[model samples]
Target: MPPRRCTASAAAGQTGSDSDLDEFIMRCLSCEEQYDMDDAGTCRECYQEANEAEEELRLEIDDLKSKVSFLTLSSPTLNPSTADIVLVPVDDSDAAPIPAHKHVLSCRSPVFNAMLENDMEERRSGTIKISDVSHDTLCAFVNYLYTAEASLDNQMACNLLVLGEKYQVKHLKTYCEKYLIAKMNWNKAIANYAFAYQYNCKQLRSASLAVILDKMDLFTQNEYYAELVDTNPRLVVEIYETYIGKQLNTAGTL
Candidate 1:
């Protein structure tokens, strides 16, 4: 047989068509056998094994997500054994900053029992002196004690805020103040105004005043002066005098 001719064109990378991949696979110097480029690029056996490993990892990830969701919804008291716990590492910076708690203490809370007994006794006597807050309020309070996370919703916070103030839970009171201050819209302001005023929440009152003042023109123009007068006549008078009357006074002075 004649020696096969090898040309510069072949060396300069002209891929022949049995599928370009096949030509490359056949050109491999290691194994003298020609094979499809797709086959040459990957060992089918190894590719299948890698695919199986990826699928297993995906399933493990999905299982972990499901477990996390289950743990989140399961109440600690109801399913104590099924709780998922995670340990977080404290860095040097985190270790260095020791938070100064104004009033953090470990003590048994008798407020719950006392309120319950008082409510029950009132109910039996037919007086019903205590309207009685709900179990959810108590649960939220207890949870706050353990986790210190103020996850109480607005209505729950309103219920608990009264309790916190009554029980002298200064921490809870402060927490309510901070959250309510951030959420000091007109409705909540009106709802909690008496409580805010009674509890001496000066900041809450001030926040409410600021909102009223900012929208004074709108209130006056829209004839909703009732909301203002209802909250504080003195405050309403102040707004009218400062914003409305003052402008009138300024015009007169001019």
Candidate 2:
């Protein structure tokens, strides 16, 4: 908000003595209250403008939310009679197949588009086998494809992000990335950094790196960091390289 207070000292330069009583007071442009200009936050115009913009944004958000609800596909039912294809979790033989429409999958992911359109084994057999994911995670992933919504948590966010990365679902990947970034702390930063780097989640990687750098000592003591060093020494080295660079810049500033 613009400061509510302004002084007539501004007018003194135009025509009055410096010590003049009339020159010492001025009315605020916004509240019309007279105050000294030297004090901080002496006006309220910026606050009013910000409030108006916020209200406009809220109205737009309501419209967008309604459109989303209208466009979202209905949640999958227990019956798969109408479904065109089934997704099988290869790791779980006893797992029930997740029924879905080929068209919806194709529209959502280019990878799925290629698989469904071409003479792939999945197209021939009508069974799309997914690997390294649990039945529950697969169901949640399919649901998000149909309706851009998911009940996310730390593990779920990480699981879905991997699937999203594999399928090249940019929106889902970004969604998961944001969730992970929001949940990240020093304790999880190293693992998140490795995961983000592996998946090419640039924004999440940056956030994780920032957290890790802030607590480098704690990162070195973390068991996950030790495991990461054993499994991917190069990524661990990259962290130190970045940290050293940041240190050098700080020293230069000093």
TM-score of each: 0.41, 0.82
Query: What's the CA error at residue 205 for candidate 2, in Å?
Result: 0.9
* TM-score of candidate 2 versus the correct structure, residues matched by position: 0.82
**Candidate 1 residues 99-132, lDDT tens each?**
1111111232344334334555422432212235
The residue pairs in collision within model 1 are 21-37
lDDT by residue (32-79, candidate 2, tens digit) is 576665643623577578778999999999999999999998756455
Give the range where candidate 1 is weakest over 10 consecutive residues by summed lDDT: 96-105
Q: How accurate locally, in lDDT, is each candidate? A: 0.53, 0.87
Query: Which sections of candidate 1 miss by over 4 Å?
Result: 1-131, 186-194, 220-254
